[model samples]
Target: MGRRPMPVGTYGKIRVESSGPKRYRARCRYRDFNGKVYDVERMGTSRTNAENNLKAAIRDWVTPVAGATVTASTRFRDVAARWLAELVRDAEREFRSWGTIDTYRNRLEGLVLPAVGDLRMNELSTPILDALCKKVRDNSSASSAKTVRAVLSGVCAYAVRHGALDANPAREITRLESKRAKNRPQKSRALTAVEVLDLLKRLDQDERAAKDDLPDLVRFFLGTGERTGEALGAHWPDFNAEARELAMSGNVIRVRGRGRIVNRGKT
Candidate 1:
């Protein structure tokens, strides 16, 4: 009634059609998937194909099942995939930039679920999590691994949020260190007098060379120190040119490229 213990790194092969005495062989092979050759332990005559397949299975290189949606089953890969599909659905309507949705979709399909996809959701453990991390650590950039880790963490979070899992095992994985980014210093750089003069000369040259509206845009940028929206909102009729001052009277700044109202001004 109980399941047999797996031969830690082995498989049992029972002798076929031997009447004199029952005999069996225990075998195992450890083949590295990261570009290493097939190797067998205690079985020099082992078939190459079998060893290859066993190595692939051990490496979690399971091929995908075609046309199967992840939601109908509780497989770790399936759930993770379904969670990402759901995320894409939500993001299509909610996301402001194409880049955000694209990045999320790619990470989900390419990294998060592939390592753990066919596994039953409840069967996921620290060992499985460790293997996934190791896979990412082997070939990906450090930042990329961190990003994939975040994706996997979120995938596990989704499982917990939807009652598919009790706790996210990925939460136990340590975050990858960001080596490429430098911390911002507290001090701000003040322009030197010569630097300021150089900037003025450049600005003057730009004023002479820039077409139609860009020079004015630059001047507006310098004047109010507000973004383009605020400048566009201000009308010449509302300004006293001789006084070099303007009253907004009734105007509002709306950010373009994004659908949101963050800044508005009227005076």
Candidate 2:
């Protein structure tokens, strides 16, 4: 059965300041289960601006839920750990990797546990998620914030699947969408026979200034057709006698880490 969407609304906020100075430092803050203040500084100089900021923060915090109570006491760090443990258990070899589990662990140990870690799962809210993502974005990569969202989504989705919660709190928090890079025309590498002959002639001259290791390096590159890093990382054991093949470990030899490599047996 499909789950129904949760109710969302605008929430009002409360603000206070010291000394009643004309120049008031107005903040948009959230109160948690333990009665502690969590600030969301969509800051403003004027009281009206501050109030608006606070109310907007509040709306962001509470509007996602139909009528759920949010508080610091509500999120339990232990529960997150438990869920991660379960993730490790249920994951298949292809589906699970050291990196993936490490991601789950990082979310629990690094972010969630540090804030509202002691509370029950029912207490998590969109505002809290928003604040956490905002903080991470300030000091960390956009990808890291997105990782946090994925972990949170898993935990919240688990809660919904188990009937422990009505809906995933993570579903309401909007992701900070990354800006798309404008596509540029790529320079083509295809060369004609005449161009290849020219390149060979240039290389013959270029060989004079080439490093002492260049000949061996170029020979290894020609034999293996491996990239610079892969060529450097390869070992003698990777070659097979019967199959006449060479093996490479992708995780062991990383490029840009946007995706995972298929697992081959460890060396």
Candidate 3:
């Protein structure tokens, strides 16, 4: 009968031998996930050290998938880079919005990466992620904390997918809470009819407003109640003169590398 192949990601028995006066080498045949077997070896000062080094190497072995280099020992920052690349690809395919991708990248670089970027994939525990979320909530705002939590979850999920982790630690974190809600007062109020008229009169008198066409823009906002992006994205073709109506077809958004573009409007 033919010899059975070793299971993928498993290695054969190790053989240690003296290479020099005090140097030793451990060697083994490892079956990678790609169904190929290769010789793996590590050198150390002593027999025990050589065996231990070989074991460590096997523990950290990862088959590169489509140019990916992530492993169990890969730093969190590296994993985040891979995840961001996937997100950018999704954006390119039109499966995700570039604005959303930009938001994730900004939150990762601005907050999440600075906190745990150096940690290895295997070192990210639930408690560590919980502490990160709490610290962001206390130092920044609840909204910022939520964004950081989401970015962490995404990165950790990517690591899990790549066999770097068994599960996503960020998924076990508690929800972020805002402590300033009780103390903060509301800052926005609807303008009265008289106030609206007064504001328009002032806009007409201001030369800068006239030059910038602010009055017309403000009128368009008030008439349609559409957001700034939606109003700015409107074209003459979207308007129906007979019905005196404009179609809400798209919104103007600025992507990082592509600059401003008209994206499909929210439903």
Candidate 4:
């Protein structure tokens, strides 16, 4: 079957037209949810700039009337503060592990916000973000680069949700591959039964292990497959003597700036 035609006045019919020598004109037709259609045009010295101009124009057209209050010219740093506030609030209500929140805070404050926090939302483009991701991959580990990418994407998502931008520009950026990611060891070794028993016997004979009850804890961990934090959070009330059953109900975690707290397990 042939493809169906989009309705007239639909958003995102952007095209670039050759102007004078090496110059270009970018134009787009956009129709908002309210059925209002707008024709936008901007001139640029290069085709890339022309395309970017049209995308920016489309974003402004679809933004709600209330978006005018915040303005697309608002600095990303201000938006990042509001984004962090919302993240903290939701994390507290849902009992998310403090480590997760700390990771987000660290990636934003230490990496993403520091690099592009002062730019306006409309000023960001896929090429700009792609270069930043490449720089991060070169300067830091692959894992750190990935985390920073996630933080940047999250910030852009927040802007979209609040109508500061029409879409997340970060989504269109491609990540550079790291040598560590491609060539690192991929296998993990698990202890066999004999090794576990030997380890338990050694723990039993150690004086410090005896004081800490490490042998029993190791046995319990091997038997239940529960994480160390979850095991630490378990208590007598969570076990039933008659049924001989135990509930893996919660996890304990220590926050960086905050104290430790227990939260319900995901499973």
Candidate 5:
């Protein structure tokens, strides 16, 4: 019978020996995550210290999986690409919407990747993520910062699942605050009936608005109270004149690479 091999990511039978007057060395055969075994050793001033050092080294050691796309040393950009691929797969499986996938990809390419793409997975600490998000919030709008934060959280969570990280650092980032919202308080008031009629009259008088069918679209919105996308996605089949009802079953959205598409309504 052949000798049994050590399990992957584990080591066997540490041996410690004196190397010099006060120096000691510990050695073992470690099977890495890739299922390859290698002789590993670590030195210390004493026997116990040497063994502990070797154990610590074994604990901290990281190697790429045989066919995995992510590792501790893999760049953030590479991991983001893998994560994006997973998102696309999710969209195909109907677990996620194509619109959501598009939003994530746009944020990754425009903001998250540009800031941290070159960094290694192990380098993404909580402080670094916090700083990155804060910088984005200061430079861009709060909505953009929120999107960036969400994207980072997804990427780091994926890293954790792939064994590239211990925990998701983005989770520790502080909540993003909207400076615009803080500076400008929103006032809520509905338009008067006269104002609404005046607006409709202006839409009816404008040649460009008339040519673009904005008046009818605005009328549909006023009558159904549906979102612009939902109203645009409405088809003749969705409306029943006998029942005087319109089914809000789809939403119009522009998807990257696929252009405009009608998807199931948000509600």
Candidate 6:
């Protein structure tokens, strides 16, 4: 199938016309949301240069200044992008893993952004955040709603820090306490010492279970209480035989398009 054409005034179209043996002209047309159209025609010694000139013009028109102060008309989408950028930078600097970045990106792009990305920074308010929390809680889990609130709060705080706003409206919003979460009973299934020993004996006797390394893995969990991913990500180097210590340094995360990735320690 053919790709859809770019909107009337939005950038991204490029046409090359030869001006000389080694010279070409790249012409671009871009339209803004206000229905205004702009035409940029540039001539360069090479086709690539001409195309790059057109792209640069498009970026100048479409991309906002990084970390710029928010104004009354600044859109939430703009601020959110900046906030996420800084988050990714900090995460990478700390040797943080891709899973952390992917989680935040998913929550923002899937849940929070759709609900309020178009709102102006100045338009954000406690009522707005309260309604957003309720909407997300109704459709998603309590944990998901809490993440959305955190993302919103982070974006608002970023805006305030950049002098875009005087205060964070999210700070004034009430906690998102879902009835489902509040009414749920706490459950724990700790194994007794005898039960643990019997399970290990049984697993050791079962050839199939032993072949799958289930016995050792189960023993590791019973001994450490570490999560499955954390255990899966553990390495021999992470253990100290002399000190009798183990480093809970990373977790296994399955990214959507990219299979499994080891996330740096939660710490």
The residue-by-residue lDDT of candidate 4 on 196-257, one tens digit each, is: 88999999999999899898899889988899988888888989999998987777887666
Sliding window of 10 residues with minimal summed lDDT for model 2: 4-13
- Give candidate 5 regions above 4 Å deviation: 1-28, 31-59, 62-66, 180-190, 198-211, 240-245
Model 1 spans > 4 angstroms off: 1-77, 88-100, 117-123, 134-142, 178-193, 203-209, 212-267
Q: Please, what is the whole-model Cα lDDT of each candidate in the order they appear?
A: 0.56, 0.59, 0.86, 0.78, 0.86, 0.79
Overlapping backbone residue pairs in candidate 5 total: 0
Tens-digit lDDT track of model 2 for 140-252: 76777788877778877765655445578787777666545479678778566787567556655675635445545555766676776565556668778799887765334
| Candidate 1 local lDDT, residue 188 | 80
What is the overall TM-score of model 1 with all chains considered together? 0.42
The order by descending TM-score is 3, 5, 4, 6, 2, 1
Candidate 1: deviation at residue 238, Å?
18
Model 2 alpha-carbon miss at residue 87, Å: 2.2
Residue 35 error for model 6, in Å?
35
Listed per candidate, the RMSD to the true structure in angstroms reads 13.3, 13.3, 4.0, 9.2, 7.0, 13.8
Compose the digit string of candidate 6's lDDT tens values, residues 1-267.
Answer: 998756754776589889988899999777755566667777778999988867765654432335666654579999999998898777567555677668878999998888899988877788998888878888876778888888899999998777666678898767777664556677878888899889999999999999999999998998888999999999889899999999888888886566887777463
Top-down lDDT ranking = 3, 5, 6, 4, 2, 1
Which stretch of 10 consecutive residues in model 6 shows the poorest summed lDDT?
A: 57-66
Query: Could you tally the backbone clashes for each prediction?
Result: 1, 11, 0, 0, 0, 3
Best by TM-score: 3
